[model samples]
Target: MTFDHYGIGHGFDRPGFGEAYFQAQGISAIHVMGRGDDWYQYADMDAAMATVRAATEGAVRVVTYGSSMGGYGALRFADAAGATDALALSPQYSLDPKVAAHERRWSQDFRRIRWRPDSNGPISCSARAVVVYDPIGPDRWHGERIAQDIACHLIRLPYTAHPVTTYLSDAGLLGPLIAGLLDGDFDPQAFRREARRNRSANGIYLGELAASQPRRRVATALSLARRALDVSPGNWHAQVSLARLLSQEGRHDEALSILAVLVQQSDRSLTYVVDLGNAFLHAGLTTEARAIADEVLSRAGDVAHLHAWAAHICWLNGDVADARRLIRRAVTLDAGNRVYLRAIIDYHFGAPYIAGVRGVRVTSWLRLARWMMKAPLRPEPAEAVRRPFPFRRRQDDSASDSAG
Candidate 1:
């Protein structure tokens, strides 16, 4: 069985993720279709689980597989679905803010649904959990949390960012890797060798590596970004990386050209549009930037990051009132994000930064300091694995999955 990432769903009307692939392979699988960005916390969850139990009741070797949000679901429902193996790629330990307060990337989706108590929490199951993640990325937090209480294999791909499967798939390693795990014969050392050898041509990895570099390595970053694009011309991340590098090098026109094409190719994806607007702003095209901001604000819905982008654009345009309003909305939607909170303080109190130092009022600085003091410390990257706990099963026990 296979699960899906957030926003990648084909909707409840279509077959769930990996249905076609599994079918083509002549494998019997049940897919759990998520209706929205609800993190599989369906109103009819009991009914869904009942259906899954019925479909997978007689399976002999069930394995639940997924990436990102789907990965979370695979682990969350493994025991209930009678799964023997749970293969999760970049899974979150929990999406509930109360449980994972350090996670802010999915605040928009988090705000879209009313979180139920204990719906999204740590993995609690008897199955063998195998998690694949980038040890240095945001997922490191979730991976560490999951490992703290449960036994699992942590497959670390450092600096690979969130999409572990994409990186593996690009290197032609995903199929063999998953096959080996399913067959219980995976050789980690050999797999690592192949992964390292193939990574030079992996576009997403190259783009991400470029973005992760410091500004002093701009030349190397640009080279990597160009190589990424050379290998995968349509890669959005690579295009964005190259554009940003160009902008930083004072090549505004080149950056704008890339961003303009990106905005068109992405069908006006808000992030890409915001990048274009920022590019224009940096190019001394205030009118164009303001126009883009107006369009974005009119159509921006509830995404916290989009509002934050609009707020920054507004602030740069000397529209302090709009900036304040927009940033307040962002902070409201994602209250746990310290960066947004700081932006709110800046916009609300007319304390815009000059030369990288905010002219913040003493009281405001004290309040910000208090919040910072309470923030959770991020864990450092390290190879981690927990020996699998013994799972007792009846002689006739069956295995099954609850795929997203």
Candidate 2:
């Protein structure tokens, strides 16, 4: 359900964004329009709460979603009426003091109003609350701080220009939002998988100490990475780095096991697929590598670099015709890419600009290099790098030596 205050005055009278989302998800929707001058008045709270209560009386669950000013109203209403869950996007806790001052100076009736959680009364709802916002926006951050103080689940979407509801009109955002709403549906396992994937793409940092001497501080770095994974098992960087370290230590089986789970969970990620395929190839699991390469190519056919990678796999299997076709398609799609262009010249025409560049080896190397370049950069894993260690400190380290 949703409430609209900002929508009414602007002649943008339509069902609220939440209402539309609910409808799209094959759920019933109720949109309550705000009436009267200055909808921010607290007097409207009771009426709104009453309306929500009446509408969702016998329902199994009731979720409240709101954005902008309506988001503020929704939070107040959810606290009062007792909703199953509340999702507020880009809400404002209160107008800026300067803005309030400006209004007060301009109008005699404009009194400074602030969001008083105490005045709204104690919240009785045990709803799994989620507040989505861009941290960079001051007005949005005000609401985010309130959500944080209340121990609400905060989903910060950095670099977003505005509220998620406005930015994510492309339907993909609904997947996560819907998944969040389902009872007992929180997937710690999925989070762990994502965390691992992210770490693999972006190098994780444990801390200043560990980062200062990465190889020399293996034990501490591993400990820190483990701790980060424990805190949020779904952190990709923690998982990836853990796996990478394991791989570096000749624990290829363990590394592959960690990456396998991530690959299974993240089928759509081209980078994940590529990484998994590479891991399999390194393990000498030819069948698995080929299967993964094929799956990635099928899903990412339009991606020129992915196609080129698949062509390399075909070439490895001695399917010259298929390899040639894929490389041709890749060259057509990305004409300016020197990597693809060079591959075509070396492989198809047997022409090498560089010295000692045999057609067969050059084609193979360029294909593999192109695939590596296509893997998406994962930044979330970098957070794990900040920790440097994932385990409890030994007594000796605290008392005796600063050096590991």
lDDT for position 102 in model 1: 68
Question: lDDT (CA) for every model shown?
Answer: 0.76, 0.56
The best candidate by lDDT is 1
- The ten-residue window of minimal lDDT in model 1 covers 385-394
Candidate 1, residue 314: the lDDT equals 79
State the number of backbone clashes in model 1: 0
Q: What lDDT score goes with residue 126 in model 1?
A: 82
Prediction 2 global C-alpha lDDT: 0.56
Error of 2 at 94 (Å): 2.0
Candidate 1 vs. true structure, TM-score: 0.78
In model 1, what lDDT does residue 200 have? 76
- Tens digits of lDDT, candidate 1, 264-299: 999999778888888888888877898898788787
